[model samples]
Target: MFKSIRWRVTTLYLILIIAALLMFSLTLKGFLEDYFITQLEDNILKETRLVRSLLKDEIVSNKRVKKIDRLVDEYSNEAEARITIIGSEGKVLGDSEQDPLKMENHLQRHEVQQSIKTGVGKSTRYSETLKINMKYLALPVKHSGNIVGVVRLALPLTQVKEALADIFSRVINAGLIAIIISLILGLSLTKRITKPIERMTEVAGEMAQGHLDQRLMVTSDDELGRLSYVFNNMADKLKNKINEISDEKNKIEAVLSSMGDGVIAVDNIGKIILFNPSAENFFEVKEEEIIGKYSLEVTRSHKLDQVVMESLEKGEEVSEEIEILYPEERIIRVKATSIKDQDEQIQGVVVVLRDITELRHLEQVRTEFVGNVSHELRTPLTSIKGYVETLLANDNPDSAIYKRFLNVVKDEADRLEQLIIDLLDLSKIESGISGKGYEAINLNQVIEDVLTIVMPKVSDKELNLKIDVPAELAMISGDESQIKRLYINLIDNAVKYTPNCGEVKVKVYEDDEKIWTEISDTGIGIPSEDLPRIFERFYRVDKARSRNLGGTGLGLSIVKHIIEQHNGMIDVESEVEKGTKFIFYFPKVK
Candidate 1:
């Protein structure tokens, strides 16, 4: 009950009313007691002085105490109080309320002792003879400048207490009535005051639950009503601001999801706050699984974490290329920049990652291609130049020496010519300049054209040739000349690599949608590691032997380009010194 505002306010009001009643009752009670006692003290003091003068001569003359007691009783009856006569020897000579002989000595009495010392004294205490609370006043009786006896008067406080009790009873009754009336009125007022507050609390709760349309009712023009007005305005503004923020958040999410680059955002503490879809693809982790984790944990790249930290701490942009080895070795270009607020304080860091693995591989391939071309051209030109110089220097040379030098120069010139032709063919294939003439061609016819060209090499090697061209093989769509060249490279390689009496086999068949060819050679095979880059231009497994065999090293690269142009795939399976097999597939003409 106390948790609600109504109960709490009513309880507080009741407590205040009770406290005020108690304070007023106590203050009035104390004031009346002090005023009555003070007035009694003054009236009794005057009566004491009058009775002192009345018996002064009798007490000084040493008259019998019985006679003095008679005079004291008469004075007490007139004053309506107890009177005591004490001799100068500290002996009680007469008492109006008791026998003088039976009473204790009055010398030790507070008022009597004081009066003996200072002429007048007053005190209030319980009187044993009267069995009531009494106020005592004393004065000295004197004769011829000597103290004779003390005349004292005592007033009973029974009437004073009765008067105060009547006043207390009346005040308490009035106070109780005031308290009950105030409590009833205060409870009603508090309920009214807190009703609007409770409504505000309900509206606030509704807003917390995403019901921003809830509003408080303004029932009055008091402070609470004005407060309700302000609250309604605040709710309107809050709902609008929240809607705007939600729209902006959705827009940002759309942009991030569509981005090709991986983006990660982190707070200044280096925890992952945002991970986009591209980042999920790059790291192979789900966004929900990795959010709130550290950046290093998600990317598994300490270098990226360092760049993010550096950007966060220094509030600067940092760009770096980091390598991630898990899942695969990928080169990622990470660009980290601090996100700052309008006050220019760093709030977080945003790191954008672009997968540059393919780009880096292309760059390396280009560099090697240029280098290999330069070397290839340089070797043949240097040999031809040396041979020509020898011919020029030998002015008186024999015919045989001139002939040998000229033939050597001619062979190098032929090598240079073939190299140039291969280079041109490869350039055309890569640039999509070749293979534009598409037609339905028979696979066996193209392979026959290729085998006819390589017949001499096969015959020279005296190798056994195996041909398994299925007569019913389906026709495929491609450039006929390019297909012939593709077969020529494979068959020529097989013929060149096979030992004397070794076998070169060619097989052609068809699958559901493709015409398949398998070329297997029982000759020296490629190593396992070099299989990936075997199709790259100018890449030679056995460079010296290949050059010696009159091979241009561009054959396989050209073959790969031709197969791609025909919308086909080529695969190689090779084991060193055992055999090598080339399988290629081209889509059948629909």
Candidate 2:
């Protein structure tokens, strides 16, 4: 429904041209009509003077007078006029187109009366002789310096009226042609002027609709063309800016998707605007299903939702941890932060989720392990210090108690040495420092070597040993020393924790793809909650008993690291005072 400017301009131009042409044609027609009327009057006065002279020069006897009269009559007929001569008594004489005897009194006529008094006169009036409207010119005839008669010429103005009418007709025709031509030309000019502008307008409209690449084409150097140039430049700049923003957005998306932690972004309206691939995997939801939905509805994480709302309300950044429970009961840690713009206003909130449940357990184990190790090492260290001080103070080198004190010192020293060795092994494994010669090794041989070293301890405890290893078990590929160290730690733990007459069993087997080993003990079994964290360095369930037993608390920690280096898995299950089971699954050598 938008009206084009071209039509509006064309309409205005046509109006102006028609008005000017009409005025000019009317004025010209008026001037031509006036000129023609004036010329006719002058010719009439001249002819009348000649007739008067001819009448005065020879009174009715002269042939020349008749010829003059015939000439006047011929002139009247040719000029389409009537000529008349009036006597001084106001009687008509020598009247053309009328008999002189029947003519009315002419002395009182407007032109005739004026001619008698002023010698010449002219008037336009209805003529009684011709019975039509006429232009009358009169002149007084003079003889011997006195007026003898008046000559009057009345010309019917029909021919002049017709001529003026013809001129007006031509003016009207010309005016009509001029108006028509002006309209045609005006339309063409308007088209040329407005077409390019219209194109620019269309481009602008498209750009407003988010087509930033739209541009105008310049076709001239006029104002419209200059405007087009500016518009095209503006469009180009807008396109570039939009592309830059798109590129930056793509980069941000790539980073978010590539991250190890899941990322989710929410707008001020609490709708999820960005949900990366990691977030989908971490939350066990699809990006399409989550994006554009309310964050609370999608994540069901009230902690994150409240944090985002509070940050938005305060116009500040906020950080917090949110826990999301999976359908399988696995927990994930989501660290959320509110995004802010340069003005320190909250734009949105970003939540990054990491699977830290295992790490949390490990951290807890490390704390417990440190506490147990500190207690275990301090006991021996205190005993050694007290015994050494007593030996140094007493100068009785041969006292019977001196031997007992030295024996006590030796036992504590031995405990301390074992603690130091265990700590060193745990440290090396954690630092991924397996000594040289990493190769494929037989699981059964490794288990046997550990059993041989712990056989003395097992026999001293009167424990029952059971081995259920198969001869055809597949070899596990890893560092030999590390694997042997792994078995030694497992067997030592079993022998240390098991009571006398308790069962200690070792088993080696193979599934289709993996080689597995399990060591179990019938001892003070670990609780289910504590089973998940038993492998952490220096961890002990019973601090007092573990220290009395001289456990360095790093046995299971070293075992866990060695299994990891071998690309294997370790799992433990226990029931308090019933039993404990440890399983190691390693990739079988091809």
Clashing pairs for model 2 are 369-538, 538-553
Cα lDDT for residue 75, model 2? 61
Which ranges of candidate 2 are over 4 A from the true structure? Answer: 1-27, 47-76, 82-373, 389-405, 457-466, 499-501
Q: Write the per-residue lDDT of candidate 2 for residues 1-590, one digit (tens) a residue.
A: 22778878887788788778777867877787779888997888777766666565532322343444565577677656687766667765566676666767878888877887777788888866568889989887766686767777887889888988887888789878887888889879988888888787788889889888777778789898898898888888888998899999999988887888878888877889888897787667998877789977876767767876886677655665456654434356655566778897777877667777778778876787677778778889999999999899888766778899999999899989988888887778778786785787877777778788999999999999999989877777888988888888788888888989999999887889998788899998998888777776666799778877877777787888888887888988788888888988989888
Q: Find the 10 residues in a row with the least total lDDT in model 2.
A: 58-67
Give per-residue lDDT, candidate 1, residue 148: 91
lDDT of each: 0.90, 0.79
Q: How many clashing pairs in candidate 2?
A: 2
TM-score of each: 0.63, 0.62
